[model samples]
Each structure stands twice: as C-alpha cells, then as structure tokens.
Target chain A: MANTHISYTALPGRSRPYFGVLYLVELVFTFGLLAIGERTRLYLGPDHLLVLRRRFFTETAHRFYFSDIQAITVQRTTNAVTANAVLFLLCALTLGVLGLYPFSGGMILLGDFSFGEELLLILACAGFGLGLALNILLGPACVTELITAVSREPLPCLSRWGTAQRALALLVPRIETAQGVPSPEFLNVQPVLAAYATPAGRLITQPPITHDSGRLHELLFGLYLLMSVSCMIDLTGNWMIKNAFDSLLFMIVLVLSCIALLRQRHSDIPSDIRSLTGFALGFSVLLFYFTRPFTMLHMFWNMPENFDPAILMSSMLNPDDPLYVAYVGTQLAVDLFVGLLGLLGIYRFRRLYRLAQHNAALDTPPPPASNVEEPPAAP
Target chain B: MSTALTAWSGTACPRCGREMERLPSNSVEPRVCPHCKTSFIALLFPAAVQNEFLGRYGEPLREESEAACFYHADKRAETACDRCGRFLCALCAIDTQDKRYCPQCLENGIRSGELPEFQSAYPRHDLLALAVACIPLMLAIPILLIVLPWATDIALGFALGLLLFPAFVTAPASLYLALRFRKTVTHPLGRRAGWFPLTVLLAAGQMVVWAVAIIVFTGSLFSEF
Candidate 1:
C-alpha cells in the first residue's frame, strides 16, 4: 500500500493591525473587556481534513472526512455594520456637543477654568472620537460557510478570499477523486460558485432566510414593548399629557402584539396577527423618530434661562442630579440608536413573518374534495 | 491479469461474483471479468475490496512453546499491544483504526474520555462561554449583598472591587472561546451564543458607572469640606 502521509498547511496569515489597536484600546480603557485573538491551522490527510483552532486558553480540532462533505459553498454577506458604526458615531458626537455646551457655560461664569477639568474633558472627547473613527474604518467582517449533508447547520469559515480559494482548490479535487464521479450536489451549488467567481465583487441577491425559530423576533418584540411602556410612564410622570396619551396608545398596541407573538411561538401564526405585530413595531419606531425634535423642544423650554453657569456645571458634575446626567448622556442620541435597532428588528421580524406564512402555506393540507351534493350526480 | 493481481487487488464483478482483472497497460481502465464478460470501475468499491483482502488473520499456535498471553496464561501470545506492550492471544487482541490496544488501555481511554471516538458530536462553546461569564458573578454577587449593609466606605470599596474579577477573568475567557469557535459550522445549541460579549460589556459598564459614582460623590463631599 502506498503510504500517504498527512500534510499540514498553515493558512496564510493576514495581519489586522486595526484589530490589534482596537484590542489595545479596549484593554487600556475597559480593562481588557472582551478582547480575543485566534490562530487556525489546516491539516490534509489521505482521506480526511482537520482544522485546528488555537486561542489563549483553549485548543479545539474539528475533523471532516472526504466522504462526509456533501457540498462546499462560498457566501458573502453585506451586513449593516457600517451603518451601525455611523449611528454610534453620531450618538457620540451628539453627546460630546451636549457635554461641551455646559462646559462652555462654566467658562462664561468662571472666566478661567482649572487645568484638571479641561484635561479630563479633552481626554474624554479624544477617546470617544478615536473609538468612533476606528469603528467606521474597520468595515464589516465577512464569513465563509461550508454546508454538509450530515449537519443541517452550515459551518462558518472566516478567511480572506485568496486563502479560502486555495483551500477550496486543495479540497474539491480530492473529494471528486474520492467519490470517483462528478457530484450532482456540486452542480447544484454552481450558482454560488459562479457568484463568487465573478469579478464584480458584489453579493448575489438572495432573500433573507430566518433560521432562529422566532426567538430573536419574540425577544425584540418583548424589548420594544418594555421600551414603549417605559416611555409612556416617563411622559405621564413629566406632565407631557399629549405625548403620554400617544405613548399609552402605542404601548397598548405593542402589548397586544407581544401577546399575539408569544401565542404564535408554538403554533402557526395567522397572517393578520403577524401583520399587526409588524405594523405595531414599525409605527412605534416612526413615532419615536418623529417625536424627537418635539421632545428636545420641550426639554429646552423647561430649562431655567437665567441660572448661573457655575451652578449648572456643579449640578452636571453631581451624580445625584439625575436630570443633568440624563442631559449629558445624550438620551436623544441613545433613543435614535435604539430606534434604528428597532427598525432593524422590524425588518427581521417581517422576514420571519413571511417565512412563517410560507411554511404555514406549505403545511396546510389542500382543502378536501368540496362537499357538493354528489347524490344528484349519482341519480 | 497475473501482473495486476500482484500490484492491485481488483473487485468482484457485480454481475457474476467472479474476481475482475484490469485491462493491460491501462491504470485507470475498467476491470474485466473473464468468466462473466462483465466490466466495471473498481475504484467505486475501493474501500470494500481493500478491507476484504488486507486483513491478515493470526496463525494458530503450533507446539505450545510460545510466550503466554498476559491475561490468559494458557493461551499462546500472537502479538503485543501497541500502547502497553502486553502480549495477547488472538481472542484478546483488539485492533483500532491506527493501533492495537490492550483491554486495560482501552478501558482507561474510555474512562478518561481522551479518545477521539468518545468526543461529543460538536464542541459546546456556548455552554463554555456562559459558564465563564456567569460563574464569577454567581460567586461575587452573594458576597457583595451580604457585606454591603455593614460595610464602611473602605469596605464597600473592597467589596465593589471584587466585581472586577468577573470582568477581567470572564471577559477574556468568553472572548477567547468565541473567537476559537467563530468558524464552527455546526452548533448543537441552535446559533452561537453572542451573550458573552454583551456580558463583558455590561460588566465594564457597571465598573464605569461605579467609578463615576464614586468620583462624583467623593468630589461633592470634598467640595463641601
């Protein structure tokens, strides 16, 4: 027997200096909060392949035999990562402006400020700006998926295009040789292969498929309901009667929608219930978006025009002053970010609803033979 | 046909159950059955043919003068265990994919769960991340609750400082696990658990909020003095 030795290939290393810098920033600022790095190695045996993943404290290896691989697909997804980053930047910028406005007032009152406060404010702004810049520049991360017949879920393999292509080149021929025939599955996946092969660098347009079993939809629905209820309570307590009434109405709709979704979790959801939930989520997000300027107007209207800037600065610095903190925290900007997230949630739910409808349509047995009077025809 | 049999073991013809012979001078040529006139590709049945012909059965003991089996003293030993070097009779010998193992070694492997065959279908990364994130919080929160009422400012500082354990320990651990499993295609737990990063973020956010609270309150008190 020919002795075919196992050959190991280290995947080409792509250095991400940006990621390193991001980790450094996190380590310095957030005290090493959620920073991780990984290295992967691929091993090609006579009849099997192994992927070795190494992390700081753990090492895991996954093996795939040639016979086990049914199909290999390369997919590119365009996520809303850049848009989310921009939204975050806008939020930070708004907060910085708001924070500096009070400092400007302090400057007017004190004539000359102490160096410590100035230094602190400058550091905060610089940190915020740097974080935002990094987020915007990094763009979205991409994932490569390998679909196997044995497992229903697709395995995600993240790598650069060239390296992934090289891996594919190494794998596909061996799989074909092992099978001793051209695979029909490979022919079926040609479209995806072609999509990747195209030089345009554009993703193939495919409808979004929901594989979450409605969990994310339900969770988001519950969150929106909670937010609406909180908004209503806040407005009512603040004596914003019109806004409170509107929020109350929205909250009632949201509550009903949440209840319907919860019920639909196990059984087939009626189209009307799904539509109602989608509509409620969409309307609530729009309401929040439209009412922002009005909310700001009300906030400015209630502020005391003649207060001393030193007292204002002191109140801002005071942890006990909830109102000032809320103002400095850029609640409006945060609200906008939340609203955008809600909008995304609504889009996902819409897809989920459509998927549910499609599945229900498939599952519903065709109507039995119409119960027309067959006796007349028999006569 | 004789030359082919010396180099390559051909498969039986599907039609007649007779051994097939490779056509002359053609490595990839279809194998032909002399008795049945049936021709077929042998590579399709490669594994079956290989396994059928490759097995070498143990020869029976001749005069009872050979080394005795480690477990069965009366039986003659045929081969030594690859792992532990224990002599085994035919009945006591077991062959794995790569090596021959003694019963004791096999049992040890099974007990320790170090053998590859004993591994679960897929790694439980989600569970690992969850444990990393929650274990410290589980230990620290109760202690904080118990110590808070009677604690002075310094004691409170010490108690709150303990919260940093979960952040520093769990954050890196969870992040490491997530990164390690990022390329995994199949997760037994539906989707990947993204809660680790969020947990890490929450821990960091709590630390920040506490630090700000301490500074503000201390600043206010000092200003009055």
Candidate 2:
C-alpha cells in the first residue's frame, strides 16, 4: 500500500571518481569519445513493476505483475572480470617483452609539451598495472534477475547490489503472498498465462525484433561488392585472365550471400536460410583462402618499380622478390583473419535463425476444439 | 472476507473481453466469464496511500516568513543544497541518494568531476593497448609516403626501422592487451575495442617482410661492392 514510487538509475561501477579523471585525461590527450546513451529506469506500481529503457532513438517499456513473478535471484557475472584479467596479463607480458628491447633516447613533442620516450613508456605501463589491480579487486559485477515461468527470458531488475536488494525487499513479499493462494490449477497456471495472457499481450503486440543483423549483412555485402568491383576494374584494365576468373568467383559468392541474407529475413523455415547462409559463408572463406596467392601476385605486379621491362617481368615471376614476399605474407594474414570472422558470423546467424523459429512457433495460434462428444459429468 | 474478493470485481477476462464475476469457493479461485467460457485470475490489492516523506512546494511568500530560495526569490526554501548550502525550493531541488542539491551546485559538481554518478563512460585500458600496438605502424604509412618516392636503400631502411618499433613493441603489446580485455561490460564510446590481435598479427607480418627485405637488399648491395 506504499504510495511512494521508487526510482533509481543503474550506473556502471567502473565510473568512479578516479576513473572519471582518467577519462577526462584520455579525452583531452587522445581525442576519445565516451558518451552513455541508453538508460534503464524502474517504477514500482501498486500491483505491478514497470521497467523503462530509454535509448537514443526509442524507449521501450515492460510491465510485470507480482502474480507472474516466480522468484528473484541475485548473482555476480564474472565475464567482464575474467576478460579484464586476461587483458592485464597480456599487457604485462607485452611490457616484459618491451623491456628486453634496447632502449634508445628520443623525445616526442606535442604542441608546447615534450614527452620523453622512457617517461611515456613508464606511464603506459603504470596505467595498465593500475587497471589490472582494479579489475582484480572489483571481481565481478552483480546482477539481480527476476525468474518467471511465463517466458524463457530472464528479467534483469538491476546491476548494483543496493538497488537490487531494495527492489527484492519490495517485490519478494508480494510474490510470496500471490503464490500462497491455494487454487485447483496451480501447476497449469504458467502455461495458461503463457498461452493466453503474457505472450499474447506482449510478444504478439510488439515483436522484439532487432535489425542489427540485417544492417551488418548489408555492410559486409556492400564492402564485398565494392572490393569485387574495384578488383574487376583493375583486372579489366590489366587484361589478366586468372585475376578476372578469381574476382568473378568471389563476386558470385558475395552476391549469393547477399541474396541468402535477404531471403533469410522473410523465410518462415529456419533450416532453409541456415543452410544457404552457411554455404555462402563457408564458400567465401574457401574462396578467399584459395585465391590469396594469385591476389598477392597481382598486387606485386602492379607495384611501381624502376627495373627494365625484362627484369620487371622476371622479378614478377620470381616468388623471392623481397617486397612481393612481404606483400604475400601480409595478404595471407589478412585472409586468415577474415576467414575466422566469417566462421563466427556463420555460427551467430544459425543461432539467430533458430531463435526466430522458436519465437515464431510460440506466436502460432492453438488448434480449434474438435466436435467429438464428451461423457456426462458425474452428479 | 468477501470484501477482499470485491476488490477484483471489474476486471475483464483476457481472452473473451467480458466482465468476470468471482465464483464462490473455499480459497481464491479464477473468475469465470459469464458471457464466454474463458476464465482469468484477477489482481486484488489495497489502493496505494499518499507518500508523506516528500516535501510539498509552498505558496509564494508575500512577507518572507523564512529564508527564500536562491533560484526563486518568491518561493519559500524547503532545503539547503548538500554541497553549496544554497537554499533550494522544490522546483529547483534535485534529489540524489538522500541528499538534495540546487541545479547550479549539481552542474558544478558534475563539471568539476566531483560526482561519479554523472560520468557517462570510463576510459578503456584495452583501447590504450591497441593504440600502442597500432599507432606506430599507422605512423609508418606517412613515413613511407615521404621516403618511398625518394628511392634510396638507406631511407627505406630508416623507414622500416621506424615502423619496426610499433610492429614489434606495440603490436605484441596490443595483441596481449586485446586478448586480456576481450570481454567488456559496457560500451565505452558506444563501441568495444576493434580486433587488436588481427591488426597486431598483420603488423608483425609486415615487419618480418620488411626486415627480410632489408637483409636481402643489404646482402645484394654487399655482393655488388
């Protein structure tokens, strides 16, 4: 019966006073941008709690009643801490390696200020070390989750301990009271809510679909198309048949990926899109890997050199051209990186497709009751 | 009591959109819709009471019974700013945690970096690693542009040497930093650090090729001499 509405903003723990100072310093020195765009707000009502998320472009609101909530669980997420720890170790190792290198005296001047090479190196090392210590001390960020039987999604209430505890104190008693009420259909309550009330009210009204994948697909496809066109133009100008053939093959794969991605967006069946996307991605990876050497050779041939025509032709044919060898090595490294990214993309798209299908199935209407006669009720 | 069940009297069934009446039972049971066969559980709770803790805004002072607000001279002051001690009316007062502050005081606190809650994002150490790893290599581009067109063995060697520092020192450092800080909690500047390992790897490869080129070019020069 409390009339007061509780409201609080969940700020990240890393935004401490010292860190703020460091952030300002980084901004001034390195031209770094640090803008917090999205904010989540919680409003406790008489019978329900409202979670409002305000983003740059839009605001989303979710309402959860006390009766629908099964349990509130508080747990610490260690993913950030583990990642920071690993980064710290790597930085420390890199510093150790740097220390083994012979020191040379140099000064870098920025406007009126002159920074000694040794001083800058020491500062960088200290900054990294401090970050490592902070990460270890902080351990993991805490998260409070509302576990509801209505849906598979875990409703995150808050991240900070104090706010989460306050929210739990307000919510837990109401949930317990609501659950304690004896009813004939206690076991079937969740299913009934899922079928008729919750999913129909929330999911069907507003499908929670994000266009991030579609945008990413467009970006990657655009870049691939651009690269293919540029390569084709060069091949046409140079009249290289082998290079043209390789470019044509890559263009085909990129086109197919674009088509599959577009089709996947509209397709009802998950497996159809999954297979097409997987094939396109897999084929692109193989194509990039297989055509890497030829691409490198073409690049080497195009490089400006002062040798006679005969010597230039001979040098282009020779794999031992130091510059060419360097170019080839660099190309191979880049290709490997792109191939790994493609593999990751394939995995991610497959998972997204499966989730979409599951959601689609959940949204489907239940079958109509049959005309079969029922037996008379016992009097 | 039956009065508790009356609190849920007017709720419409979710499925049938018809008024549902509470059926008499031993315990609280689902209200069956009379118009349709659909049934629903209704939420029954006491009406919310007014909060007494919040200070109400007072009327404009004609003769100033107490101190006036710093921002609004006509309004009576309810509380003093926690930081600056300036008197604040309910309109100008911003409540954070348990403390109350005037608008200017709050702004000043945020501008001077005294308040942590006002901060948007933190500086990423992982990004620093990537910058350290890649900056020198990137710097090499301009150096190559200036020197490459000149066409001298020594100038190319010098450019390569300059590039090597970032390639060897920054690249490995960046790679290690990227690996360590691979997981992120919040998006600092609306972006996580880019793939530092791949960048470092590419830089390292470039450095090796340049080093080999230098060695071979020098060897060829010595053979000619």
Candidate 3:
C-alpha cells in the first residue's frame, strides 16, 4: 500500500504556524489527559476512575460547544496547559500504579538461564507489542485517506442525482437552502428530464426527496460517543485503584488526538483513513479492555504468594477480595459492551464519510439547459 | 442576440444555470456553467468524461470476437491463439483440459509426456539406471556388517533394502516426470507395474548385497566363537 500520512499542515485554508501551535497544544494536552485519567483509575480501582472517564465522552458529545468555548477562552491562554499537565501528571502516576498488574508469567529468578531462550522470549513479546500498536494506528489511517481521495476526485459522489437531489430540491425549495444548491452547470434539469422522460410531452419530475442521513448520523455519533465514554470510564475506574498516572495520561492524550479526527467534518478527510483509524482506535481500546480482566486473572490472582501488591496499588483495594469482584465484573462487562459499541462507531464513521461525499455531490451546481441540449447537428 | 452568443461561449455555468461575465481566454480561473450553474473544479478532467473513464476504460467491447477451438469446431474457446486468430472448433481442438492446446502446443507439452519409444530404444535398459542408483543403498547392510558387529547384520540387510527401494523408484521417478513433462504420466497397463520395473531392479540388487553381508558376518561370528 503506497499510503500517504495526511498532515494537517497541508490543509488549504489554515496557515503553518497556527497548525504547529495547535499540534503542540493538542499533543501536550492529550498526553496530560491520558496521564491523569490513567493515574486516577489506578487510585480509584476501575470503578471510581470510570466515572471520571465518562466525562470525556460527555465532553466529546458537546465538542461543538466546547470548540466554540475553547476557541474563545484558550485562544491566547498560555498558562492553562501547565496546570492541566501537572494535574494530569498526578493522575497518571496514580493510574499507572493501577494500570500495572503483576507480570502475567510468574517471576523467574533464575539468574543463570540460557541467553538464547531469554532473547527469544523478549523478541517475541516486542514483536507482538509492535504488531498490536501498528494495527491500532494504521487501520484507521488507511480508511480516512481513501475517503478523502475519492471525494476530492471528479466523479459525482451521489448515489442518485436525478431521482434524489433534483426531486428533493424541486419539491421542497425551502430545504434547498439547507442542502445548499448544486452548481447549475453540472445539473442540467432539462436534459435529466429529457433523458428519462415520461410518455407525456411535458417535462417529467421525480417525487419529493427524502434523505435519512440526519437520523443515521445522529445514531452513529451517539454510539461512538457512548462507547468512547464507557471505555474511558472503565480505564479510569481501574486506574484509580492501581495509581497508574502514566496510563491515564496516555488515554488523555489519545482523546485529544481524536480532535484532529473531528477535523474531518470541516475539511474532506479520506473515508478509508477515518475508518482505519476508527477501527484501530476502537480495537486498541478493546484490546486494553480484554487485557484488564486477563491480567487480573492471570497476573494478580496467580502471583507468587510472597509478591507485593504495593507497587501496583494506588489504594489498599484488593481486586481478589470478594468486595472487589463485583467491581471487576462490572468493569469487564462495560468494557465488553464498549468494545462492541466501538465496532458500531466504526460502521457509523464509514456511513458518515460516504454521506459527506454524497452531500458534496448534491452540493455541486447543475449544468445549463443549453449545454444539456444535444450538440448542434454534427454537420 | 450578440450578447447572448457571447455569454453562451464565455461564462455559462455547467451546473447551477447561472451566467457570468466572460473572462479573457487565457484566464485560468474556473467558471460556473451558466445553464446548470454548476461550479467546475480546476486541475481536473470534466465530471462526465471522468465517469466514462472509470466505467469503461480497458474493458472489453461487445464487438470483440469470442475465441474458438482448433480440433473441435463446435466448442467455443476462451483463450486466443498465440499467433493466429483462427477459431479452433471443438473437433479440431486439443483438450489439455486445464489449458487449451492448439496443434502447436507440443514444445510446451512434450516434457510433460514420457520419452517416446523411438528416442529410447532400450526399454528394458531403463531398469539398469534404477539398479545403479539402488545398488549403493542395497549394499548398506554389508557396510553396516563390516562397520558394526555380526548380530545386527541380517536385520540391517532388510531395513536398508526396504527404505531404498521405495525412495529410489517412487519419489525420484514421480518428481522427475512432474518436472520434465509438466503432465503427470499414467501407465495404461498395470498402474504399479510401470514403476515396478525400477523397484524390482533395485530390490534384486539389495537382496544380493544382503545375502553377502549375512554370510560374511555369520561366518565371522562363528570364527570368533
């Protein structure tokens, strides 16, 4: 795959300096958020931290509002990032403690083990980790890139022009303002009728247009927002108990990076890349979700009798205790549910990307009546 | 009348049906087609032509003729003749089933078939080549007898022959024919008998070696006792 990494730096309307600043701010804040969320979860033990993580989704759902506020408030605010970063760091530390589990395999204290075996095992783990990360990142990038490429090209993106957009525009002239009018040149109202004319001598018109896009978009964005929030909650709650601030910070940064993805709405981001990223992000969250239960069951519960939980615990909460089992099971169920929801989010993102292309096509201007007329007799 | 002509020639929109002031001919700015009032993009082919390109380029035209076989006049073929366009009808076609073969497919198909009788006159001599390769394996028992002790010598004789016979006759022959002819050859006679020639030669050589090893080893054992 000869793939290009779409740089936000290349968008037409924006300047390089502005984008650079945004990137830096975005990255720092994102990292900080992840760190905080992770730390909080570690301290709070999956349950309490998850409640905090739900805020991110709520924040994302209200991003348009946040964007307006952020655009105004943070426009020149230089000092906010520092305070946020510090808080994020504290949370990340706590979350990190919770993020970590006793290493899944029992402690191997054999000092004289063969070099080859150790080397192979380490190599295997590193390879697996790298592959996991690649799947996490590359999948979404590929989809969005393809969507952008196809949309920017010459072919009309609409599934049906004559029957849908034209009919819709003609029947409900009022709705035309919302859909916006196509350029008159590409849409030859006269020829379209002539091409698929009825037996009647008069021009034929298709019935009123009905686009189900609004409901679809609402459904998708809603699902995505829900899933993302749930995952955030699950991670945060777990991290609060463990005190792993680093993991929390990483998740915070991840949420911020998603803002760049929302730029797809403003500019034409490729659908393939968006889908790929959605799948990757969704799947990574899913992996982390599955890993949590597996880690607790395999690593903590089965740890050597003498192993200390102090390094892993931000609080005195014992996950193996009967009191915590309900919490663990609840978190696991939520994680699974969100993992499934993320898949639905991916589907919605694809559906929306396609709809954007369609709307863009509908937005194209129609061709003139004279141009639609059969070219003057050849001779 | 003159202004209408000027407007049509210069600044008509292809999409939104809006007319615009005609700019200088050399201007690179994209204009809206006046009739449909659609704004066309710059640095791209027109939309209608682009759709045609996507749908039809490199696609087969309906006017293109279907391929026919050489031997079987009635049979319609899919692949074309490498040299000639003549349709080979069913009766005139060679059915190499996986691939359609015309009369000229010999050079490709020859190695896939067995060597002709005229080329190799010594039909039975072919068995000698099998014996030469098998002889070394058959003699493994005698060598083992000399290398090791008398007690295991007889058993080694049978083991060496059994392993050598199949490997020499079956694997090598099948592999060679597959590589050479590309087509698998089947014996019209007893299916195993065609290969049996090679196996028998190899087996006889192995038996001779085994008997010699047994006698030498057993006699030596008696002498030692």
Highest-DockQ candidate:
1
Alpha-carbon DockQ of candidate 2:
0.02
- Model 2: per-residue Cα lDDT over A1-379, one tens digit each: 0112334333222232232334444444333322233345565555666565543323355556766664343443433343454345434533642353333122111111122233433555676676666655654444454434443223333543444555555555555565554343432222222221243344323222233344344344444445445443442233347556756766775676666555554333233223335444644554355335433544443544563665544444344333333333333433344445444555566577679789999999876666556788999
lDDT of 2 at B189: 23
Cα lDDT tens digits, model 3, A247-332, are 56447535743653454332233333334334434444544554455345444433555666664442324443322343334334
Task: Please list the C-alpha lDDT of all candidates, in the order they appear.
Answer: 0.48, 0.48, 0.33
Candidate 2's C-alpha runs over 4 A off are: A1-253, A262-267, A275-279, A282-286, A289-294, A298-379, B1-93, B102-107, B117-120, B123-156, B159-225
Tens-place lDDT per residue, model 1, A1-379, is: 0111345444443323233454564344333333345434565666766565544334456666766554443333222243334445444544554465464555322233334334433554565566556545644333344433223122233333344555666766676677654433322222111111112343323222122344544555555545545444453343346446656765665665566555443333322334445444444454356336533433343445776755644433343333333432443334344445545655665687688689999999877678544566554
Q: Against the true two-chain complex, what DockQ does each candidate achieve?
A: 0.03, 0.02, 0.01
User: Tens digits of per-residue lDDT for model 2 on B1-225?
Assistant: 011101112244443333444333221233444533333333322111111334466557667577898888999788899988998888888998778888898888766756645543344555455456656655665566556545489988877777675565665666666666676422312344465556556556755765797899899999999
* Interface RMSD for candidates 1 onward, in order: 20.8, 17.0, 29.7
Write down the DockQ of candidate 1.
0.03
- Listed in order, each prediction's TM-score against the native is 0.39, 0.30, 0.24
Better of 2 and 3 by TM-score: 2
How much is A358 displaced in model 1, in angstroms? 11
Summarize candidate 3's per-residue lDDT along B94-118 as a digit string, tens digits.
4442444445553434443322211
Task: List ranges where model 1 is wrong by over 4 Å.
Answer: A1-7, A12-50, A57-68, A73-87, A94-139, A142-314, A317-330, A333-373, A376-379, B1-98, B102-225
